[model samples]
Target: MRRTTDRTAPPTPPPRADIDQRTAERLPVTLPVTYTIHDPAGPIEGTTVTSNLSGTGVGFRIQQPVAPASPCRLRLTLPQRTDPLHFTGRVAWCRKIPHDSPQTFEVQVGLALSTPADVREEPSFATYCHFVASELVKRYLG
Candidate 1:
């Protein structure tokens, strides 16, 4: 059997909410982060790796879809830090990767972290953010 493609087929239009919008600069780094989804009934916990990191939010992948505006607790494990950095964040958006097969697609979640009472006081968190931002600048702009 032979399959033929239509040369005149139109390309699929991109989604309206493009994830490329960067309010804050982000670095492409992979870090393991344990997250607990905050639900009224109970909490659902899972492990995932961060796709990118920035001062405001992080993008990570998950096997299942998480609702937008869901509060979550993240414990990020960075190579420079001995102890995982703990923080609270709110789900800003959720999108599934466009794949030919729906079953193989992974859900990407963007979380906007709630500012700590004293960001200056949290040296480790501040250091980690600086590290990521520096790396991003070094790679792209430096």
Candidate 2:
């Protein structure tokens, strides 16, 4: 008889939300989200909506679990903006919920603001950041 062991990792401890570690406040802003993730299983792509938005990061729901620290591409459609913003971001976090689709159920993903797009994308992501920052300054100062 042979013994088998599954490659399981220790679960990451949940963050202390009470601490309010966020640098920028997240707003309940819903925008369009089309994301693509490349994993060992394959490439996963889906159209979803953002759960929240912030200057430093974005929270959106997708169909698959995107590995943390992986580079994921996203196209965000801002309201009243005719052009969709395309950018690549590092997967900051994700949480999955049990759904009808086996273990690969719905998962919410968080993406950190990464570097400007160099290829296969545009630089609108950085522009969006600037727009948000300016808005904040205006609201508080102006």
Best by TM-score: 1
lDDT of 1 by residue, 1-142 (tens): 1212212224457656957643677667799999997745567689989998888888898766666677999988887667888888887777676569756877777788887678778775686677776777788889
Off by over 4 Å in 1: 1-22, 39-42, 98-100, 140-142
lDDT of each: 0.75, 0.71
Q: For candidate 2, what is the lDDT?
A: 0.71
Q: Cα RMSD (Å) per model?
A: 9.2, 8.2
Candidate No. with top lDDT: 1
Worst 10 residues of 2 by lDDT: 1-10
Which residue pairs come into collision in candidate 2?
none
